[model samples]
Target: MKRTIKATFMAAMVGMSALGAEAADYKQNPFTLVYDGAIAKNEPGKVNIHPVTYRLNGLNIAANVYTPANYDPAKKYPAVVVAHPNGGVKEQVAGLYAQRLAEQGYITVAADAAYQGASEGQPRNVDKPANRIEDIHGMADFISQYAGVDQQRLGLLGICGGGGYSLAAAQTDKRFKALATLSMFNSGRVRRNGYVDSQLETILQRLQQASAARAQESAGGEVLYAGDANLTDEQIAKLPFALYRQGYEYYWKTYAHPNSTFKYTMSSLLDLMRFDATNQIELIDKPLLMIAGSKADSLYMSKEAFPKASGTQDKELFLLDGATHIETYWVPEYVDAAMGKLTTFYARTL
Candidate 1:
């Protein structure tokens, strides 16, 4: 009986250990880099990450610039500016892609939006559409002047919500010689109509709530936040959508960072409701390449926006078969596939 009890105890301990490992799946690394393929330590002659800061619209913006191996400032090379997703920081997927592009011999940069991440801003988490688009433009401004970058060959790559804002930024910014978006997420559409348009009838009611939140802020009342609430492991498991479920696992569990949160100010919806990723798309007449997962529920956003870019004489939509939206953020096969296409697209255009 003693032996039997010992075996049972050992079994229970192993099970608990597995649970613990699973629980911390998305937790940050000791060095605090949360994305896969992150730079553990910068090596001088290898692909290196350089943290930078600059002033944009009176705000101090933090960014990470990745330089290719054997980089020479005197020799000009093509560059790509990667925009982070909504509620995402420069250290997340944006950094992942930047590092990858740098490995492919391009100078790449990923930056924190002004009001989020390491950037300085007041009334934090103000995620308006205009601000997001400006963040992309600001990245271009800095990278175009960075050492070793070829201003004439500047490229733009945006992931998720960043993809939408990148579209808007490229519309008027002819400086971007080529543009590509991965898992493009239309924030304005999702904010105004709800994910998958599930809350279409309630749009007016939600708009009213946003207005009230703004009014409360103006009156110096307690500030209200949206999407900042924390969730228990059990609650997260129960989330219905694959994007939310897998996203929670990726962003909150395995690759979590203290500076990253899923929050935005409730009042930002005032401007968001008036925005659309496809607005003025015709103004973007450069090369365009959009990629999304074939199985992604959010695939419609890319499909809807692709055709509207009619002004672009060259545009292509590439889908990663059998992959979901969030999977493209971290899954190796999906990322590799996307990167393969990106290398070809940028090589041809830049």
Candidate 2:
């Protein structure tokens, strides 16, 4: 139980994080997307997925832009920037939602964060809060310049760790007319304080370890990492938290993608420990919508950040009945429910 708790909690700070050994064949997938209902090929007069790349802070960012059916570069359209989860790539749930939103007649883009997935960066999987937040801003920067995107009618959607970072990004990025988060996970809070603050007593001990990791990196020694555990089916099933138990199945088995992994440089904790998603949340004056499963163990994250968004009178905390954290990622019913709310929210606000 102790080992399971440690392994699960370490991987649970973001969206759906887990160790995956097998890589899904991208050759079979033209766009290399692993989500269900993904576009296999582009066709005329139908929703299309365009694989694109752009520069962000000197790193190459890989992204997929979804255009609504009958999309015309000559015609204006609202756009949304979708940020992936902590260990997630652009082809997972982020792609799923981007495609879905495109179907609703909105242009959307889901991008791989720098240092993760296909995006270029050294010491891969460096999941720092600042980088993740900047990734959101970068996506907006790119999409707003796209052919038909209306800069004034832009929206933002962040999932899991991306959600937490979205909150931070939206606080100052007024370009986003509205913002939404699904199954939001406060990565900093979970990293420094532990799941539900379970490891509060070890705060100093962990800080010392993170400090050592930074020292090692500075000295040109071995790079240390966290949240990179390989577990068997039985071990995964034995995980106490549904967020991780199902997450393992989602990222490692069902929706497994080669670029996804629950690992980050240990030195990242130096910045993560002091960060908080809700630190200046009230600065977000745009309309906000935060959705989480009512039964989700991570629901508290959304609830905690919701009230702190006191700057927005148009904020809402909608709960999907009988849904769990991981379930909201792939479950059709929950996805549909979330999409409905998102469509309405963006339509009303954007």
Candidate 3:
């Protein structure tokens, strides 16, 4: 078993290294907010995009809502709320998925979690699990009453860290008729266990550090952060895990955005240390679909969490063959595979 695990991990690492060496550069038009795949403008009488804001838990949340071609206010349309990945904003993969879903005749909304992206908050980059779950709920709340959305047909799609929060949110919200996730990264598990459970021995020490960071915050001392460093190519290649190494390549090199960052307040770990995405997961009685890359190192997270959702009989675990953890974010073929499955699942359920 140990040998198999080691080999699987090494294979994933080597695959990501090849990906990192590719010369693909992501360039965007700042004026139009266009992203990968040449997403066209929201021309009149065609599919349109709307930027919106609303107050949630006393904080102003920023979000982008997309409506299908020739949208009519008099007609009701099914809606999906998309949750962005950790260290990701609404303008990246979440927006891509939202735009695709809108093209399929569903009204979709993707939002930046409070304190992250263009949203309003203090002491930015505080990545608390509870705040993330609330962001999902807040998206549902706003979109349910939007111009032509049918509240009864509400659905959700969360990617990476957002996926874990979506699971936690859907466990009780019930407002979401269907729930889906792509390349789900269990944030709490990774934070507590250190990626692939390699830091088990340091758990107590990390928790102590987190506690001290909290104390510093309470005393108005200098703020402390974690995982907020720049890495060179050599440094990145030397990282122990493929996820972290490729993650740096993705966020820093290819899809770099000023607001998107990997740093988070160390004090936030107080809540994260105890949070588990699979805790009370059985409470999700709605239809569920969890998608991951067949060759992704993070695939184990989805596999582990899928069976714990015992309350729902309507569930599926899909793997996009030949794709890795980060490739599904922008790779056309993999994105198409994921979108095809999502379209079918949401159409059937919602």
Question: Which numbered prediction scores highest in lDDT against the true structure?
Answer: 2
Q: For each candidate, what TM-score against the reference?
A: 0.91, 0.96, 0.92
Note the Cα lDDT for every prediction shown: 0.81, 0.89, 0.82
- Which one wins on TM-score? 2
Stretches of candidate 2 above 4 Å error? Answer: 1-6, 17-27
lDDT score at residue 46, model 3, on the 0-100 scale: 70
Residue-wise C-alpha lDDT for candidate 1, range 1-350, written one tens digit per residue: 32232222111111100112233323344335667667777877889888989999999999999999999999999999999887777777888899999999999999999889899997898888889889999999999999999999999999988999999999999999999999898888877776777658878987898899999999999777767556666665565556776666666666566677776777988998778999989899999999999988789899999989999879999999988887787778888999999999999999
Clashing pairs in 2: none
Error of 1 at 311 (Å): 0.5
Candidate 1 — worst ten consecutive residues by lDDT sum?
A: 10-19
lDDT of 3 by residue, 1-350 (tens): 33333222222321221254343334435323434753555687777888899999999999999999999989999999999888888877788899999999999999999999999998998889999999999999999999999999999999988898999999999999999999888888877776677757778988999999999999999778776666667766776666766666666666666777777788988888799999999999999999999988788999999999999999999999988888888788899999999999999999
Per-model clash counts, in order, read 7, 0, 0
What residue runs in model 3 are displaced by over 4 Å at the alpha carbon? 1-34, 38-40
Residue 256 accuracy (lDDT) in model 3: 63
Q: How displaced is residue 219 in candidate 3, in Å? A: 0.7
